[model samples]
Target: KKTVTFFLVVLLAVSLFTQNDMVSAEIKPKERSVGKKCLEITCTMTYTTQQCSTHCIQMGYATGDCLPKEAAKPQPPEYCCCYFEK
Candidate 1:
């Protein structure tokens, strides 16, 4: 009976530790995609990394008609910098 009790206690402890590790893994930070396109024009002034990225992508798509493969530059307006200077 004592041996059975010892085994049960060990099993429970191992199960608890494994569950904790699984929970921690789920909580880990997700990887962000770098150099993603920016969609919103206002987002440029806002200076949010994700927004700017989306805008760049949209611009690339729209202007792809005019420019060659590498010619289109995702240039944020000077006013965008002005907005943040204050």
Candidate 2:
């Protein structure tokens, strides 16, 4: 009985954690555009900043970095992992 109870508790904990993770993962922040299209180029990230060489010519530039889009990066809104193509 003790073993069964312990197992049940562990199962419950795992299920709860998994549910929380799923909920957090599903939640996403909004995306803003910078208004430009950019050339396809590999960008470098320095301690100070990470930037791409492309012209960023898309009509709608992302509010933040145009690299990691929501679909691509999977992070919250502060940074823009997505970009609008020309």
Candidate 3:
């Protein structure tokens, strides 16, 4: 009985660690893809989508938009977020 319990404990620990690694591995690719495609630029509320796209094009990105700041307070200043192909 003691040996069975020990084996189960080890198996549980290994499974937990592997599950965490798999979760992180799944998340990392999304983070890397977004990091590669997006650039955040400070901008005012008056910044337009066309202007943002034009600026991004000039800077070599495929497109852009004036979007709200991530994880910011409600009604935060907009950012010119540019997207590009990898």
- Estimate the TM-score of every prediction: 0.42, 0.37, 0.44
Candidate 1: worst-modelled 10 consecutive residues by lDDT: 77-86
Predicted structure 2: lDDT: 0.47
Order of models, best TM-score first: 3, 1, 2
Error of 1 at 74 (Å): 8.1
lDDT of 1 by residue, 9-81 (tens): 9999999999999999999988754332222234333555444444444554322111112226644342111
The alpha-carbon lDDT assigned to residue 72 of candidate 3 equals 56
Residues 19-51, model 2: lDDT tens digits: 999989789655653443333343344411144
lDDT of 3 by residue, 1-86 (tens): 99999999999999999999999998775433433233466665565778888998898877887766664563556677787655
lDDT of 1: 0.45
Best of the candidates, lDDT: 3
Clash count for each candidate, listed in order shown: 9, 18, 0
lDDT of each: 0.45, 0.47, 0.73
Better candidate number, 1 or 2, judged by TM-score: 1
Better of 1 and 3 by lDDT: 3
